[model samples]
Target: MKSVQVFAPATVANVVCGYDILGFAVDAPGDEVTMRLTSTPGIRISKITGDDGRLPLDPAKNTVSASVQHYLNALGQPSLGIDIELHKKMPIGSGLGSSSASTVAGLFAINTLLDNPLTTMDLVPFAMKGEELACGHGHADNVAPALLGGFVLIRSYEPLDIIKLPFPEDMCVAIVYPEVDVPTRDARQIIRSKVQLKDAVTQWGNVAGLVSGLFMKDYALIGRSMVDVLVEPARSILIPDFYQLRELALAQGGIGFGISGSGPSVFALTKDPETAKRITNTLQQHLQKIGIRSLSFVSSVNQQGPVVIG
Candidate 1:
């Protein structure tokens, strides 16, 4: 059996305006997994390091372990012994798509270690299993961007369909991950089941406008279109001074911002890298005043997603 490596970049989901439906990749901060095949029957994983002793090592319970299992099952090959070491480059549950990155990297790593039986296009559905296990809901918005790279819109989930959108060149995304974790399940629960008609109309219009803004490469319109009434208002309760921070960022040249992948982590998009830098600094300063210190990144869109390693 050949040993191989896989690398998956970190991702930011729900880029302010697009919730549960949009995401993009970032460079420098991602997880790396090393996979080696074993002659022993039955797939097993060892969580060697990273994650600050927070991740589960159980093969049956962890996302990376489960992803390898899916690959083995699909091949119908004899149970293979697989050992993986996940380098947790990013903090878990920081809304930077830590789990999705792990899940995607695991899938790609194992697929390569097994001699590449499945095509990349065919593997996204398998990668999503870990997401389902972690989030209790099968949402590919985050995983897709992590797996496929660039900006992604999950147009539909019935057939696990996804559409990739171009990342405008001038725009940059800055993210702030507060040192807290908000379970996706709990965050989902906080949202109001039914929204006011006015809010609903406004949201949908914004969604359409955002999509159009992407096509037109109009940063201002895209910034204007990022408004959420149903999820943000309800979920913001989990964060400290969410509304104030959001307003301050906007006033300081942040095109727009919303809860990033549930809560705690917040992100803003800007017209240029300067604006992105400003937004990043402003968010950090404001968040500190509220006693909520955060780690921030000023990054542009990533064109590459998860890829096989040598």
Candidate 2:
């Protein structure tokens, strides 16, 4: 194939207690990339849509093109001729893995056009280059699930060990992206470098409980374990009415509620789609009442990470 278009699902990272460690993909709010081989010698980003001219077009600066370039360089093809068009279906910096989705889409597109030169997992490091470019840190919480789908746990970053965790098949997520800005870089800066020993112990237990709940299919355990004492306390202040939203979600039959990634976007977990929709609708209505325009989505866990669309 000379060209291929691919779609990669948006992800919810730092899933509450598992900050920088856990994440899961959602079905909607994804990004698409169209890439074609060209006679030219280097990667070129020809178009970027839905960013309102906020994203860079230069291949070296853009996450999508930079990721593709990383993949090419890794394969010993430093001068591969490729052109990419990024279609941002989701809001940038929405705490929904927007950059990761686009990066995964781009990397997948090039790999598909090259006839599957690399496995999805193999493309992760290249995708991290995009994350490093987009945000200062090369974290994998968003990119891992965006690439592998389902829930992922970063067991170790030193050796880059990623473990895909089991989740309830009927698990539904309600996402709300309020019209607020919460840059990941700024959010990260506010977090405390040192945590109290008691808080650390509690966080560890919650993370373990969450993982166990997923494996055991215990929704209640999952709900209880979704508490985050480390990062959410610092980051929640960046989002408007974060505590009120969480209370609303819980009152509306949500299994759990927490910030999606950094802030400005939050998510609630529900057992059924109806409850998920209700939560999102109610949340959006509340945000509207507060004079905050918002976007909401109800989605099951995305099992397919990336797909060739064209």
Q: Model 1 over residues 1-310: C-alpha lDDT tens digits?
A: 6676678888877766577788878764678887777777765665556777888888888888887687778788637777777878877887778888888888888767656688665777877888888878778877888888888898778866788887587677777787766888888887777778987788878888888888888878888888876777788888878888788788878877877788688888877678777877887887788787788877777787887666
Q: For model 1, state the Cα shift of residue 267 in Å.
A: 0.6
TM-score against native, each model? 0.93, 0.99
**Can you tell me which runs of candidate 1 are displaced by over 4 Å?**
308-310
Task: Evaluate model 1: give its lDDT.
Answer: 0.78
**Candidate 2, residue 74: how far the Cα is off, in Å:** 1.1
33 in model 2: Cα distance from truth in Å? 0.3
In terms of lDDT, which candidate is strongest? 2
lDDT for each candidate structure: 0.78, 0.93
What C-alpha lDDT does candidate 2 achieve relative to the native structure? 0.93
Backbone clashes, each candidate: 0, 0
- Residue 46 in candidate 2, Cα distance off native in Å: 1.2
